[model samples]
Target: MVELSGKSDPFQHSFPNAVFYIPALIVVSAVAFFGYKLYKSLTEKDRKREEKLKAKQAKKKK
Candidate 1:
């Protein structure tokens, strides 16, 4: 016959550890998202500057 212990399942102990990591994961994700956005914004700004410079040069050539 198989024996079953009355104590809580071993898996239950890991639940708290899992929960504890949730906040850390969320914080890391948020930082990564913000960092990506900042990088994108900077890249866009640089592109716009390049376009402006090209336009100015074109005007001078005319």
Candidate 2:
């Protein structure tokens, strides 16, 4: 084994650009989750409105 060793790299302590991607990924995931929730709520509202309309028509027929 070689006994003589040089100094370690100076850039080892400096963070790379890839570290910034972690926060970006979290933000994207949060946006997607909220968007999905919005879509689900809108669809539920439409479904309830349709049900009310159908019940009104049925009552009129009877």
Q: In terms of TM-score, which candidate is strongest?
A: 1
Q: Give me the displacement of residue 45 in model 1, in angstroms.
A: 0.5
Clash pairs, model 2 backbone: none
Which residue segments of model 1 deviate by more than 4 Å? 1-15
| Candidate 1 structure, TM-score to reference | 0.72
lDDT of 2 by residue, 5-56 (tens): 3457543344556677889999999999999999999999999999999999
**Lowest summed lDDT window (length 10), candidate 2:** 1-10
Off by over 4 Å in 2: 1-13
lDDT tens digits, residues 1-62, model 1? 22244356663222446665789999999999999999999999999999999999999999
User: Which numbered prediction scores highest in lDDT against the true structure?
Assistant: 2
Per-candidate clashes come to 0, 0
Error of 2 at 31 (Å): 0.3
- lDDT of candidate 1? 0.81
TM-score of each: 0.72, 0.72
Q: How far in Å is the alpha carbon of 35 misplaced in model 2?
A: 0.3
Lowest-sum lDDT 10-residue window in model 1? 6-15
